[model samples]
Target chain A: MNPEESLKFSYYPGCSVATTAAESNHSLMQVCRLLGLDLQELEDWNCCGSSSAYSVDPELGFNLSARNLSLAPGDRPLLVMCPRCLHHLRHTHLEMQQDPRKRRAQERRWGRPISPDLEIVHFLEALIRFGLDRLKKGAARNLNGLKFVPYYGCTLFRPPALRRQKYYQAEVENILTALGGVAVTRTYNQRCCGSFLSAVKPELVTSLVNDIIGSAVAAGADCLVTTCAMCQLNLEVRCTAAKRLPIFHFSEILALALGAKDCQGWFIRHLVNPRPLLKDRGLLGPPRLGQVP
Target chain B: MNSQPMPAKTTEVINISELDHHFATEVDRRSQADLKRCYQCRTCGNGCPFVEAMDYPPYGVIRLVQFGMRQKALECATIWVCVSCHTCSSQCPNSIDIAAIMDTLRSMALEERAVIGNKEILAFHLEVLHSIERYGRTHKLGIMLRHKLLTGQWFKDVDVGLRMLTKRKLDLVASKVRAMDEINRLFLPYWRVKPR
Candidate 1:
């Protein structure tokens, strides 16, 4: 239990983090590395079936998540980034734990033993468990009193399926406040980001996103930070409000505070362009040559 | 903005003979939620963020299931419109897990070939599943392109699409799982074999 010793975790970055929210993935990696956490990507891991698989075929979604569980080595906790992925994985695990017959059938299907005792921890929980002191020691930059709303995007602690488990109500605020950022508590932090509706019903999602961003702006916050990558994407892409605040993935701000240097690449991927806000707060340096303004 | 008219409450008389008495039991078994405990407090409906878009509020859908109105429960736009954000479930005084009930109702709708209340939403989901089936992981750019083709709304979100492309948010190549056969076998269930 040495604080400085790197803790090993099998990381599962769901679809959004891998592609649409790669900046989150990049920043998460940067933050983890800075905090001396070793994240080994789960090998040959497939989709958790996302909301679609479960929506169309629940059994398919169950098996898809079970496959990822079977792949994880039981020795260490499996780390998940996406809130939806974490829910699906943990729900599947809970189901398997309740029904031995189902677990045995899945184990036979994959030809690998599914460990019932494997701990599935979200990145936020892992940071709280192992990285607080490390965060204190590794603080490389002041947050300049940057005010941000901790938007959990409806899935982190709301799902009834996992209600008995950990509730991450103020974990984001605690971590960021420790880093010198101010947490704005009056905004719509847990509002739905219109998940898939952002694509099918853009107008509806536009209004919802506008309401969320509008509330944040009204709360006198500098920006919004979210733990879920999909929330980050939906908030950025669907906002049609006359006033918009840049949405930062929790990892981006965490990485910036920990002195991650290659953040220009992450900032360029944002549609809202958080550079001005970062520059105003003095969290980011002045634009370098060839950097996007 | 595309909200449907609120469902007629009392204009439609309930024909008890037409009720499928076993529908509620089936949903209860599948979802493992205590639907019978819902006292119609409307706490769920009140807390639902997307209730404006749904024809029936969360409790109204529960009532449909309770009344054994199978077709109404399965074919209602509320089930499809729900993104399973669990706002209702969390706020429900009865702890009924309303979102799980919606999930069960959606799957049952697909299984029974009931008319889908929202075809576009179902189409978007199918595109995502198809991408997962092929790559073992969802490919955002591919899902979006194919979804546009299926819905034939290619020009609707073209600006957002272009913006994402410029930001390099969409990866051209999907990250695939190394074990393709194992991932493929999960889709062998006949119902899912034919991607709609």
Candidate 2:
């Protein structure tokens, strides 16, 4: 009962999150609520514009995105689960901070001063910061014999944009370990999944998705867990051929470890059914086939 | 009627209206500084793994855009061909954000009904976006079925599907709608407005 000891954060579920990774936001909301973490959603936020804007017009892209950064309600740090949003926000912050003139011009465009008061941290980092011991004790199901591939994609470390970092892979591994799952670190973990290719050249995406999936599958990982919605969608949906291998969002796993049954309630609708792996790991009780209940 | 060949001097007069200001606005909005920096070194094309199959290599399109030849640039398959790996941005000596700009162009092209070549790919993107709007996260089989149905390419990829099926790859079910109401409330507004 020391409720005061439980940490709370402001949640930012980006565009992809509200649409494509709804399960992640849902699961995160439920699991965090149960864990006594308070997450208040910001009001009237726009798309981070992601990597898309950087290539078109850097200033306008950053200005539009900076307006979003300016709109976050109050001084608390923003908790982001999407890696794309993380990259956008962090990159925007770094660029704005590095150049005073650019920052001032961006401020003029946004009609407001964009202060770096809010520190953006990924959910995986939050799990570690909250301490793995607590997460381990909270697990209702010990994920025994469950092997997973941690798909980092390209966002975790890129553009040499941010410093003050710990070992990214180790951080993710530590969190997974606390949840009773094993992480299989592989070369392709940090590689590109040709995420934007899903739009224009899917044949290329299909082939690239195959390679990323092949690497994970070959590494003997039963599924791929990631913090990026784009990576999750690309790996799970683009591989029309290998759709059986589930790609669980990190929020889903955290929800599971927190003993929230709602994850299973929503799990039924997952593109790639996770029952086979969950059953083998004893994560789900009994065999419930083709049933959301 | 016998057609008169245009004089060389007249050919030099560029029609600026054909430049696609909408696309230019989008590109300028996204890659303002970087777009002018591209110099057609073919580094972007050379680095792109899919360039060999593309109708217009990426670098050439940048050159076309720089020269303000709108129709020719927009008509090419370069935007559709880019994989958005950032290899070009990483390798470019001038710091051009080529891949991201390409994404913006595709988004604009999608909006203007200007899309050409790779109809199947366009269908897939729309399918995935639609699925997310409907269920708030794509269901693999649903996306595949929609993409295949819309493109009439279902049977074409059946071999890939079969191999995956034999290997226990494809799943036959959809994801659970645990908090369907919340998902609906959040997603409905965007679809109502339609993407621009």
Candidate 3:
């Protein structure tokens, strides 16, 4: 275990994580243990004020993220599982730095105003921080033959002003290599899958998601891996059994490579079955007593 | 944003006003995009996924914004239907964040009680905000039920919901964050965004 990877960091799981994506949360926790990483949940951390916040009131979004920023102790760089959280935090930081007047207002309002220079550690960045070389060498099992088309969705590497630069998408491919898997780069990977629209406009979401998944199928990917939980759910919900390829959170696959047993139990939460594919490929390990695969 | 043919246009003399000019400035201030920098290239309209559904496609909305046509722009479903995907921004030769500008426009529309072209999307956004205000995270099942009731679209995704319930993908229970008061403090202001 690398001593540097053992560094403790503030963790924010966002909202959907605790509720809808329990499997992702559990797998991520297990993977952290395997990597010798320490993740302490932010005490009384509020929502990052996702898409809904920004849509309702521009100022409200920044304020919501600012509240969390003030709550975040200076002990470690804040870690966020959701890319939307990463986007909101970075936006909040930049907006605060740009507007001193608003900063003062926030300070007076929060009573714990912070000159927040804390680095945001997105989950993908943390995986790379674990050192791709060490991860590949450390893998007890290799998903060598599996094809992964790493999906960035939006927010992570789009709208140039938000993301630091053109970084996360390429690092995702690198992480895929570290897992001893083939990353399909020849097709559409960075396109948005009509995220929140899955709730309001299912038809539009279906079409956009189809365009994304269609490109991956054409590129011969065995499975699609995503960083955003919203994207994971959208892709899975949009994909029918005919077009269904297991859309996995990056943490889920990382947990597998990090030697967490009972991948079946971890994936039981998925509506679209990933077990048949993983099991057929001889990756789920020998069947257990009472295991139904 | 792209180098392709644009949607068909209809000829109608656009009227601009003092208030309309002010509307453009407000949008530019809020979104930080120089509306004058746009060349009417129709690039953003070309790559937008929801263009077919939009009342005024991306470039059309930008043109309306440039002309300070606030009512015309807000009345169109284009702003609300945008998924904020940034495809247009990425393809912009002038480096304009059309998507971000769209975001600003939506917020302004909400603040003003302006004509929102998509009632369902606004309702959905409101429901989600309502959840986040109370629980600090969106309650998915709550949003679905509320949206269906609000939209009167019963039996929508019911089978999918059943499958999800069986799979335990949907959490029937809800939990609020420890700091509900703090969350409310952040939210109460936004709820009354409309003019007093």
Return the TM-score for each candidate structure: 0.95, 0.64, 0.92
Interface root-mean-square deviation, each candidate: 0.8, 8.0, 1.4
Error of 2 at B96 (Å): 10
| Model 2 stretches with alpha carbons more than 4 Å out | A1-6, A101-113, A162-167, A285-293, B1-80, B87-196
Supply candidate 1's per-residue lDDT for A250.
95
- In terms of lDDT, the poorest run of 10 residues in model 1 chain A is A284-293
Candidates arranged by TM-score, highest first: 1, 3, 2
Pick out the ten consecutive residues of candidate 1 chain B with the lowest summed lDDT. Answer: B1-10
For model 2 chain B, the run of ten residues with the poorest summed lDDT? B1-10
lDDT of 3 at B157: 83
Best by DockQ: 1
Q: Could you give candidate 2's per-residue lDDT for residues B9-111 as a string of tens digits? A: 5456567666645545556675543676676676666656566556666777676667666666665776765656565666677777776667666655555
- Sort candidate 2 into its docking category: incorrect
Q: Which ten residues in a row have the lowest lDDT in candidate 2 chain A?
A: A284-293
Which digits, one per residue and each the tens of the lDDT, describe model 3 over residues A1-293?
35564467889998877667878888889888887788988887767877887876767788888888887776577888888888888778777777778777887877885675667778877776767777766566767467989888877877657745325668877776766678998766877778787887887778778878888898899899888888988888876535768888888887887677757776888877898888876568742332211
Cα lDDT for residue A132, candidate 2: 71
DockQ for every prediction shown = 0.82, 0.09, 0.65
Summed backbone clashes in each candidate are 0, 12, 1
The lDDT ranking, best first, is 1, 3, 2
